[model samples]
Target: MKIKMKKFGVLLFAFLGLVSCSDDDDANVDPPFEGQSKSYDLTEVGESGVSGTATFDENEDGSVTITLDLDGTSEGVMHPAHIHFNSAAEGGEIALSLEPVDGDTGISETTVEMLDDKETEISFEDLMDFDGYINVHASADDLETLVAQTDIGGNALTGESVSYDLAEVDVEGVSGTATFYERENGETLVELDLEGTTEGNSHPAHIHMGSVEDAPGDIAITLTSVDGASGMSFTNVAMTDGTDDEEGTAVSYEDLIAYDGYINVHASADNLATLAAQGNIGANATEE
Candidate 1:
């Protein structure tokens, strides 16, 4: 009977040792997310030459550092930068204020532990879960004017797309699709695919300043001319004033949320007065 009891005690001790070992292994397992870092492409907005990238890195201490780098800014100008509470498309409120970027050098380094509202203390992991974006204003005095920006973290458009169906205008049997690809470079690439048009003639396309409801405005961005033979035009565009002299306008994808903009395709390079096709763009524009 003593031998039997001793054997049972030994078995029990072995089982307990196994359980302890399992618990230790579980404790050593790393978390699903220990750290995170993301880079956002900032596009030109309005007339400001501001454009760059915002990189957010999570530190071991749980704080976040935002590094802003840009180009095409005027020397001696100060641009106000911020981290807003939502995606650029949604136009969110300011959640955190970053160090203002120098327009001349186009750089800003900001460390954040709390929000601009000051009611909330935000950590790097918190920012990863938060829906937010970065915005660079034209100047400190012109806070309302956004010159460059991009969505951050999960707010970014990954593998997403937007399109507009163009209609025949002035010229019958001429139409196309205006598709915008949200690229990682912080610039939207627009592809114009047209049909019912002649070959060997280049068609000038522009994103105008108005919608169909208000009649198309002047050229906002001059897109790459469509190939007469292929009926396709591809342009990696920064919003502009539709001039060769100017590039990368302050208009961005976020501005398209309520933008009164439209796409206009001219009949031919020489026939700039004639429209081959036209379509409203952005949230206010006709969507397919």
Candidate 2:
């Protein structure tokens, strides 16, 4: 009976020690927080054809991790990504630098204990108060050009889809369709699809001030030139009255609906004087 009692006590002590270690492990584990994540859907900027999502995660180690999953970039190209101060519409300055995004996978993962120019660690709660945005540049060499971006905590775009039909001007059998998509970021993406165009030629296209009545009054916004082989052009509208000095125009989508305009597709870049095709757009536009 004594031998049996001593064996039973030893077993009980081992069990208690195991339980104490288990409790210690449990105490070190971090609790899950339901509202510790923030997600933002990014969009294309400056005709870069890039779009993606940025997710910010608050880790248990007091560090914030940001993951960016993107698309519409060439493989093997590296892009510079950063957190900027203020909204995208306001063209904010970079506040925090992040790891360069890889083009092959289009993924950027970065962690932050604080901003690049700051010293103190920033909490997840305090980061929510950050009046900032994220902007992905074309590359390390071209930081001024933005490819994909989004406002962190700002108003989104809710607008309409508008399209127009083009007719042959001086060039026969040259025509196209121009579609304007109002993006969630309040920018307009104009895509031109043309047919019966010369295979080796490039067509310069633009949004003009007038319609059939005016016959290309003035160039309002320059568009991406259409490739002859694909007969397609995709550009973000910058209604700046076709000036070399103007950065961007003040024209909004609301103003576009009430403005009179048209589209002009030229035969070549050097031959802007000759129009291959033209279309009435905006207030005078005809929908099909």
lDDT of each: 0.79, 0.79
- What is the lDDT for 192 in model 1? 92
Return the TM-score for candidate 1, rounded to 2 decimals: 0.50
Whole-model lDDT, model 1: 0.79
Off by over 4 Å in 2: 1-53, 56-64, 69-108, 112-159, 196-200, 242-249
Winner by TM-score: 2
Write one digit per residue (lDDT tens) for candidate 1, span 131-238: 778889878778889889877765565565688888998988889888886644455667799998778788998887878777647767778888777788876554
> Given candidate 2, what's the lDDT at residue 41?
83
Could you tell me which 10 consecutive residues in candidate 2 have the lowest summed lDDT?
Answer: 151-160
Clashes of each: 4, 0
